[model samples]
Target: MDAKTFKVEDTKNGTDHMLPMSDVLHALFLQRHNDTGEEQYVFRREGKKGHLVDVRDSVKKVRDKSDLSFTVHDLRRSFITCAEGLDISPYTLKKLLNHKATGDVTSGYLVITAERLRAAMQQITDAILQHAEIEKTTLIQRDNL
Candidate 1:
């Protein structure tokens, strides 16, 4: 991952997209990189893809431990709902989700930069963290590391 953005392979579209990272994400990714060293994939595992593809088992374990009922798609849906609630631009949200604006001519004309996406991502992340009752000071302290 770059300091501000990460490249993700969109399996649905068979394309790669660069998505901005929020400050919290940047910190977390930096820590992960440090722990894993220079690996081809950030979240590598002994899998067919050599990286985390299906998280169902992990999610199931978490669900069993915490008694939480949710799926991976639920998280995506929640993110989209949160982004929409935060009034992030439709195009930016689409880009964030790595969704192509098929049949939309207007979307083709818009150029959303990494910086812009970073700002949007930070905003959404902040809102989500705040709603989750995570203190801002805790995030600030993490960013310092």
Candidate 2:
């Protein structure tokens, strides 16, 4: 595929950001699109044209049912920590998080490539899978680690 992407708009910084979607993300989004083909919003209220204004209660409900004790922000922190552990370049990570670069002279000259970003994303995915003891169809035998 040539440059598959999804975008988020109206950020706190007053900018629209577009991000390339990885294969798995693309698949998930495609599924959502298909499921909500006739709807104006993918996760809308009943008979509404817009999406739900808040998903915190839904997230909390699920969190309460699970053994994991983490807020949505915790997941964000975990993702960043895992990506850093995989040695992703700070620039790439910043871009992934849609964070503005600091006033570093070198950051101005850096042009991050899609291929490099994809590689970093894949590494992060692999790392997450490994952490969950999931690889392919089998749970990685913990003793092997």
Query: Which one is best on lDDT?
Result: 1
lDDT tens digits by residue: candidate 2, 1-145: 2466665666557787777766555555555666788775546665556776666876877788775677877877988999998888999998887789878888889999767777777778778877887653343232322
TM-score of 1: 0.84
Reference-based TM-score of each model: 0.84, 0.77
- The TM-score of predicted model 2 comes to 0.77
Q: Residue by residue across 1-145, what tens digits does model 1's lDDT show?
A: 6567788765678998888889888877877778677676767765444677766787898899889899978988989899899999999999888887999999989989888899989999998998998865586564544
Colliding pairs, model 1? none
In candidate 1, position 8 carries an lDDT of 70
Candidate 2: count the clashes.
Answer: 0
On TM-score, the leading prediction is 1
**C-alpha displacement of 46 in model 1, angstroms?**
4.4
- Candidate 1: stretches off by over 4 Å: 46-49, 136-145
